[model samples]
Target: MGMAVVTLVLAIPLLAALGLVLVPGYRTPARLNIAASAATFLASLTLFVVEPAATKWFVLDAFNIYLIALTAFVGLTTSLFSAGYIAHEIRIGKLKPLQLRFYHAMYQAFLFTMLLALSANNLGVMWVAVEGATLTTVLMVSLYRTAAGIEAAWKYFILCGVGIALALFGTILMYMAAQPVMGPGMAAMTWTELMVRMPEVNPKVLNLAFVFLLIGYGTKVGLAPLHAWLPDAHAEGPTPISAVLSGLLLNVAIYAVLRFKMLLAANGAAIAPGPLMVAMGLGSLLLAGFMLYRRRDIKRFFAYSSIEHMGIITFAFGMGGPLANFAGLLHMAMHSLTKSAIFYAVGHATQIKGTQRMDAIRGLTVSHPALGWGLLAGVVAIAGLPPFGIFMSEFLLVTSTFARQPLLALPLAAGILIAFGALVLRVQQICFGAPDGVSKAVPVAWSLLPLYAHLGLVLVAGVWIPGPLVAWFQTVAALLG
Candidate 1:
């Protein structure tokens, strides 16, 4: 019964998405999409109330339960944001009703993909789910059919497609690697079964599998060198889509990578996954830190920030102590909330300004004070400033890193400082000083509510995590090892 409910929770959005495309009325589809997403979130809430257990093709455990809840929660909020955002796009002639229909359908499909990736008990199923998300977003990214939008969508499709293909190869290699020990059957490929039998798997096969999987899923995670598709996708897609890309999609991708890392760890003789992840994590941090100073598009700027924080989280896991792992988990949750909140504000700002060019956008404080300040607060929080959950999590990551590897601390600190300065400079230009042009006011009621809710949650978590949640995180972090 539990497995059936969980499967239904994951599948509802995909079914709704198909209905959204086939159904005629716009308002009805929009309402249905929002209601479906909200119900999905409510169903995921059962994770906290229900005990941990495995069902035939799925498992409910500490490691994934919170992420399931978080993904569903963010999916609901983004659906609400999309409702308003697409409506505004139609109102302004930026998008036609036909495109809005595509947008609505694609949005639900994207949610369904992420949910599947999170809940899958088989590694191959998880990879397939991640690939499914990549395909859905390609359509959404190109919904505008503008030159830039089309180009961005193509780039996203090509890169992520190739990356996911590599990940699939890695998955196959893992299966092959496990077959000798666990025997060639479905039993050899199940994540839980593999974890239990991993110690007996060949070390050489595990090492090679890790290398391929890292570069493959790492692309989806937006790690550097593999990250070229991210900025264009963010710059051209609907802002609500950008919100989910940074907030939810990237987290889902990282989750895929972590699952593989767990498999590698279980094979005791395999080369430690820590050093490779650490190197990639540090490399992404340094690259994104330098790249931050040069972004002209606001969304692109934050996309790089997503890369930077993912690096930090990757680094935390790479460090591999209980404290670092705990901090990594917290950072992932905090980054998803804070980054998505920022994108929410950015979406509204771009809409009001009628352009994404940084220079064309100025004096957001005068134009849309609610959105302007919300972006500013989100910026402050994401830059690892105090009173935000990111700051506390980042502080813990750095402290843990310093204790173990003091020399690497300088570059880490430098990256944080550089990102901080760049974010403040661009944000100040947009939010304050002089009015850029004629100002337009959006309804403060709907747009600002989700932004503030996310920010307030990050803030509260920074000050203190409730006992139940903290305990939950600690348990999950232990499992990460």
Candidate 2:
């Protein structure tokens, strides 16, 4: 049953991707995409019920099981949102019928790569999976074939190409670091084996390997300075892709970083990775905060917001304690849900208004109350407002930092406040003002359902968390240390 579940989890997406490309038309492929995503999500849930499974290619544990569940859930919701979104695009001639076949195929392929990366037991295979994710998303980003879209895709491809190459070098370095201890076999490249034997590995070489690995995966995580590709990719890609990129793909890179961080922790002589991660996280937070102030495009503005939230999550993990790590994990889940929900609302709003520019879209509440209010609720949650899941996570992070690293807490709080101002300002302009006379199509019940479902979960999380989930996060937090 263990093997069957894992196999089914992967096989569904792989088979669906191939079949989707051959299947013609819009509705059937969209339904298939949603169905495949839903089945994969259900399969991933069985990981928690079944015992942990570790084979040559895949491994499932407390560390990854919760994340796999989160990824699968978001992927399912995004597919639900995408089905409606793509149909509208086709109606307006923005996307031809045939392009959607490729789109559906690539979407599944992207999910497969992410799931593979998270579940991988071998270091080399994990790196390959991350690279595969980059390639698949690049094609999707340029699906519209516009000048801006193509440019974003090229930029995404080149920057991430360089980043993945660095990651490959880092993977080699990790294998080299392990080979001496494990003595030249598959064990040297295996994650489970490496963790078991981490203490015997040379700390100096491990230190060097970690630096390269951090930079390589950090770029994909959208850390500042290396985040050049993120905003462009988010702004120009199909909204469904943007939704998953934040909700799912970035977490894959974060998962990679945590995997290596575990190795570093197991070695007593290795340099502390916490301070370095904290520095990068702090830098990304402040940089994104100020950048949000100058943003004109709504999606780009929120893209920076994603960076800021990633920075916050990184900072919490970097603090390295049971409380901080727990907060980081919670924030990771919260941000994924809240941000993706925002993108869904944004996708529909932009469709009604016919533009992504902030100035061009106004009076949404007055004109389209459902979308306007939905977008408002999403932005509020994302901006770390009270009575929402994100606020709880951010509060925990801030308090944890104040107790352990008070000096760092000041800037972190400031960055959050700065972003809050910008988001509130921008959302107010779009939701409350006079209507732009361009809206023709109203979003159907299915589109809004997924958006509200996500936000609803987040809201519930703020006030009450399930007992089992709290226990699960606590277990993983210990493992992180």
Q: Which candidate is the best by lDDT?
A: 2
Task: List model 2 lDDT by residue over 1-481, tens digit each.
Answer: 6667877888889999999989899899999999999999999988888887788888888988888889999999999999999999999998998677688999999999998898889999999999999999999999988999999999999989999899888889988988887899788888888888999999999999999999999999999889999999999999999999998899899999999999999987899899989999999999999999899998998899999999998888889899999999999999999999999999998888778999998988898888788889999999999899999999998998899878999999999998899898888898997787856789997789989999999999998999999999999999999
Clashes of 1: 0
For 140-245, candidate 1 gives per-residue lDDT tens digits of: 8887899999999999999999899999999999999999988888887799999999999999988988899999999999998899999899888889899999
TM-score of each: 0.98, 0.99
For model 1 the TM-score comes to 0.98
Error (Å) of candidate 1 at residue 386 is: 1.0
RMSD of 1: 1.2
Question: What lDDT, from 0 to 1, does candidate 1 have?
Answer: 0.87
Q: How far is candidate 2 from the true structure (C-alpha RMSD, Å)?
A: 0.9
Q: Which residues of candidate 2, in runs, are more than 4 Å off? A: none
